[model samples]
Target: MSDSNTTDFTNPSTFILLGIPGLEAVHVWISIPFSVIYAIAVLGNLTILFIVKLEPSLHEPMYYFLCMLAITDLVLSTSTLPKILSIFWFNSREIDFNACLTQVYFIQCFAAIESGILAAMALDRYVAICHPLRHSTILTKPLVAKIGLAVLLRNGIVVMPYPFLLMRWSYCRTNIIPEPYCVHIAVVKLACSDTRVNSYYGLFVLFFVLGLDVIFIAISYMQILRAIFILPTKDARLKTFLTCGSHLCAIVIFYIPSVIYSLIYRFGQNFPQHVHVLLGNMHFLLPPMLNPIIYGMKTKQIRGRLLGLVTR
Candidate 1:
């Protein structure tokens, strides 16, 4: 076969990633900071998981969901960090097609799972605050376990079509992806064939995964708030609100940036390049770091358990 025919038979099997724009000049050096942050994110989430598991007192539904959230954070950070480090530190921006697809799949899965976990946490708060008499009956051990499994399965199914769709495309010539990690949109942009199908699927998944999850969480909190206002005693109202404060903060941090990002990318056609990378990292990194901090700071029980485990 001729050179053109040989090349035509198969799509390009590798891609180059153009990381953070201005920082490209110092990619190797910039990676040092990212490496430290990634290490902290991983270690922090793992610590929370360990603390939740070791504390027999934390065997409640709330802590169980917290542990699940920690696990999801680990997955999210792991999905993007190593590849980012490779691109920045080692100048190894070339990713095999399978590896890229694997990264995209895991990133989507982790993100979707995180959303579902957050919604579950909100529901737990709702029941504990709004229906204290029935909290135990509603959020039983088996029920929490089932919800956790459902989160994983739902996210897996939602993201399953992403990698499959990617595999069908032909990369004619474009191979450079303008992002730090193998984001789904960036991957689809390289495909030579029409990507309307993939784009529509992504939109549908985003609406269901992030939009539906956020709406459900908000509705759960709204009910909790309504119940809180009806409490006859001022102290009772204060206590319930205090108990939910950390979760409220976490939900805001996790979802606001995501919503803002979607809006900007959709409307701001010429948004700065740095903004995309920054928002991407923030959405992935901040929630994991803040979640543990929020729980540790707001909940005395978690702090006491962590201190006891450390001193022992």
Candidate 2:
């Protein structure tokens, strides 16, 4: 810590987070469910990773894309859970301004990359189902690896500027944040400086990173649907739909709550603080807990291996 003489208290170096404000009485109770979800998310994603690696037959392009999704889920869950649990269990809410920005960076980066991975997965499905013969040629192992790397790098490079942008704005107002975590606009609201520039940049990034991915993913699914309907045999169409079912469920699980939260955050000014806080936490936690479950229930190969692993 800097000496008191060396620091300006007006523009504070530390900020306090009010974790799920208005629910302090049941924080410990909330922690139970949160802990269970976090454990499942971590264990489930790790299981998918290990099963993919152990089963050589699962080393196809599709499974590789699933692996990327699982890795992103793991990263996403880790970024949110530790700090949140600390808030819930121990009431440790003081975070360095720099650390808060760092957490937001990873939170946003992993989220954008997850969206990118979903788009890539959609593309892989489109190629496989629509152009089966060319699927092998188009989605080679090296190509899949390249796609994964591109998603990671794209989000990492894009989100790198955010913390720097926030640094430019002087935070002269209250140092208390109302949410459990350092969300962008939430943190920005605490800044006494003009925040229009930061807000605009956030919107731009949101549209470019997540919005663009949504468009591509939607397009991929449309093409897949068109191709599926054109198939001559009922069995063939059913098979195609089944294969896509898991990814579609995953997309819905991730994006629906995300979009809802974004809408509420931007426009639901009349909503209660707890409403915003609860939604924010759920938006991060739900997909991680459900993604592997969706895959296990819908994807046959994953189900088979999961069963074998459980029994063994």
Candidate 3:
């Protein structure tokens, strides 16, 4: 509250998200593809949502998780793309500190939630294939509701605090964040205050939250594979593999780039800033846009229902 302690926070407190770092000359051109991707991600995910909700057969656990995933993807893309496109198309890069913090929070929240949903879906498949008799009883509607709530709460409890922690830091620098969007560490690094706690807790969440989700998903697959290999019939094994293919694809698309991006942000001190920025952008963009398409193609019931809706 005192003028002595408060440095001038308004001069450049507004961050200029220098999208793509050095590629500012033709941001409009860049906006074209990003615009297209954002549009598809939103509309495609929404379509998946609508179909899942309206169809009675999709009221089951797997489809419910799919709906959850679709909703997460929609929010994840919505949280960042508007500002990013604004920067790209209109050169409107000025963002309020609190607003940027809000963006970072929701973006991180939905991203963590998505990873959680994927882990749940893997478990759903595990129940379905590995324990066929118990699958329905185990993943009932009530249990699905609980799982969804747990994912929401788990992510909210973990990720929502980081932005507040970020807000506590004194940011007296150029206020120009180098990434295309307001990433957590990228924004935190600009603060004049010591960010050791932020950095340390970030690693904690990375390993404890997101990293644990990835590990559990891998473990679920290992169990699912083990179960499949021991099945009595070749046809049964092949069917089980097909059932899980969409999930495997979704996991690979999301986590591979995500892990690389996180590792580079934390450890690749010598890597170029633009490389970090680009990988971060792709981590959010590609998976959301492609996930719905993967399900529509791979799952017969979804594909058939999607086609029926499309024909109408």
TM-score quality measure for candidate 3? 0.93
The 10-residue segment of model 2 with minimum total lDDT is 1-10
Best by lDDT: 2
Q: Point out the higher-scoring one by TM-score: 1 or 2.
A: 2
How should the candidates be ordered by TM-score, best one leading? 2, 3, 1
The lDDT for every candidate, in the order shown, is 0.84, 0.87, 0.86
lDDT of 3: 0.86
- Which lDDT tens digits does candidate 3 get at residues 19-80? 88777787888889899999999888998888888888888899999999999998899888
Worst 10 residues of 1 by lDDT: 1-10
Error of 2 at 84 (Å): 0.9
Per-residue alpha-carbon lDDT of model 1 for 1-312, expressed as tens digits?
Answer: 121312443466776777786678988878887887788778777888888778788889999999998888888888888888887877777777788899999888998898899899999999998888999999999999999999999999989999999999887747677888788888887777899999899889989898899889879988988999999999989988999888888888888888887787778778888787778778887887778888887888888988887798
User: What's the TM-score of each model vs. the native?
Assistant: 0.93, 0.95, 0.93
Ranking by lDDT: 2, 3, 1
Off by over 4 Å in 1: 1-10
Give Cα distance to truth, residue 288, candidate 1, Å.
1.9
lDDT of 1: 0.84
